[model samples]
Target: MIEENRFPVIETDRLNLRQVTKDDAESILAYLSDQDVMKHYGLEPFDSIDDALDEIAWYQAIFEKKTGIRWGITLKEQGRIIGSCGFLNIVSEHRRSEIGFELSKEYWGNGMASEALESVITYGFEQLNLQRVQALIEPPNISSQRLVERKGFIREGLLRNYEFTCGKFDDLLMYSLLKQDYEKMSYST
Candidate 1:
């Protein structure tokens, strides 16, 4: 069952996924303001620390509403956040939620995203008792596409013009990992 009163902190070999606090606003703004990093993030690059504060507020709101949880990804050696990842749009009745994540460009290609994703997926299926975790990726975001595929998320189909963001309609590819599939992959590995 999902924890309703406390945020869960997940630790991996090299990373710590913890609750995002107001103090993290500056770090969050640093990456969220980067044009390259925000390219596929749907929203435009953040302009001020207020944007980051708003994001942190959203994180808190989602948790309070019991609709989602997002973790700030920090290095084990350095406690500052370098990225964030988690499940959103959770529907307990349906046992499903959407998974999303983003990392600082400096940390790209370091396998951190994959590591974090594995932990989050495990928590979703095992701890949250979710049956399905889905991801929506833009067609041009090849790295994200590969990341989810490597984690055994099957391509469901294209969501044509599904989101109108940054002044344009964008197509998103829908992918999902079922609990059964996760268990199979777990046993195989």
Candidate 2:
């Protein structure tokens, strides 16, 4: 079984992956409500600040229950939350999980997502003993698809009409990396 309580924080070279909390409402609102960030993700603009606050509370509750791990990605130099990243839909028995992430528009093209995902993928394999890690990217999200590919995740296939978002069904592309592949890359580097 995965021990969710054993690890709380993961540090990357330029970012700190810390647990999401209700107090993060303000910071999360800064990006979560941005229309640019939510556009291709099939989410509507946050109608009110209260919506962001409630979302943070919901994430905190999920963290407390050991259902998933969410992190506020804070830049080390400024100590400001520029993004969020984490594992979702963890299935311990199957030794697999889905990964999700988002960054403030300002941080785009800076390789922050790639850096953070590398660190988190390492943690999932080495610390959590997961056998596989996967990312589901909407087809039009070319940036995210490139990020996953750059991380050495192979394109598995497409899940047709896999999710309903932005008023209609959307297709998803699945990409995955195995524990063995990660280990090989680690040793090679």
Candidate 3:
């Protein structure tokens, strides 16, 4: 189980999904500043490391408010922060949250995202007592869509022109996973 309720450090074979700190700003800026990394990220890429520092403040504020938590993904062997993943929104009364993630370009296609996600998702369901988790992905991000689906999220529907990002309106595909669904998946194994 989780010792610290909010923003618990999660460990896996290749990664550690740990609490985000101001010290990680430089590491996070590497990806957040990359256009390719932020292509479908629903926001403009960070132009400076200060932007990442601001994001670190945002992450800490959200956790302090109990509204959301973002974990910095640490590649243990490499000893550097490679990415981030966590609940983008937490609707406490509804017992659900919106999940989001981003990984450095160098780490893409290596299954590291899945490893970090699995740890956080498990923490959400088992420790946070969340009943459902939802993910919103831009239509063009096939890899992200596949990542969530492989973890048992079912495609709910399409939200046409749901957001304005990167200077244009974009459509998003919605996907969700129920706690019961995850439970079934665990028991089956």
Candidate 4:
């Protein structure tokens, strides 16, 4: 079972993945409010700080419930959140979870998301002993699709109109990385 007593902090060469705090509301709002960043995020841009606060609260709720963990992505030199990534809907018995992430537009093509995602995935497999890590991506999110593909997540199938967000139902592509697959990847590297 995944531990809920302490939040794990993951660090890479350029980024730190730590718990999201109320103080990060403004930063969270900065990107989450941007239409381009939130385009495939399944929600409308947040217009108020309260919306960001609600998001932080949801992060807390999921952690407390042992259902998910979201880490704020920050630079080691400047510790303000630039984005976030984590696993959600964890099913311990099944050893599976859903992965999600987003970054500020300013940081989009700099490989920050990939760095944070790699750390999160390693924790999910190594610490949580998760057997399967999956991602549900909107078909139009080509960048995200490419990122996960590079990480070895195989496209399972397209879930036609799988989710309803921002007014209408949208198609989502289901992708997964199994433990055996991850093991093979680790060996190849």
Per-model CA lDDT versus the true structure: 0.94, 0.81, 0.86, 0.93
**Location of the lowest summed lDDT over 10 successive residues in candidate 3:** 1-10
Tens-digit per-residue lDDT, 87-187, candidate 2 = 77778879898888899999999888888888888878887788989999998899999888877899999999999987899999999999888887752
Q: How far off is residue 3 in model 1, in Å?
A: 3.4
Poorest 10 consecutive residues by lDDT, candidate 1: 180-189
Q: What does candidate 3 score in Cα RMSD to the true structure?
A: 2.3
Clashes of each: 0, 0, 0, 0
lDDT of 4 by residue, 55-168 (tens): 999999999999999999999999999999998999989999999999999999989998899888888888989999999999889999999999899999999989889899
Which one is best on lDDT? 1
User: In terms of TM-score, which candidate is stronger, 2 or 4?
Assistant: 4
Worst 10 residues of 4 by lDDT: 180-189
RMSD of each: 1.3, 1.9, 2.3, 1.4
* Candidate 4: segments with Cα more than 4 A from true spot: 186-189
Error of 3 at 33 (Å): 1.0
Query: Can you give the TM-score per candidate against the true fold?
Result: 0.97, 0.92, 0.93, 0.97
Over 4 Å off, model 1 = 187-189
Candidate numbers sorted by lDDT from highest down: 1, 4, 3, 2
lDDT (tens digit, per residue) of candidate 1 on 1-189: 567678999999999999999999999999999999999999999999999999999999998898999999999999998999999999999999999999999999999999999999999998999999999999999999999999999999999999999999999999999999999885222
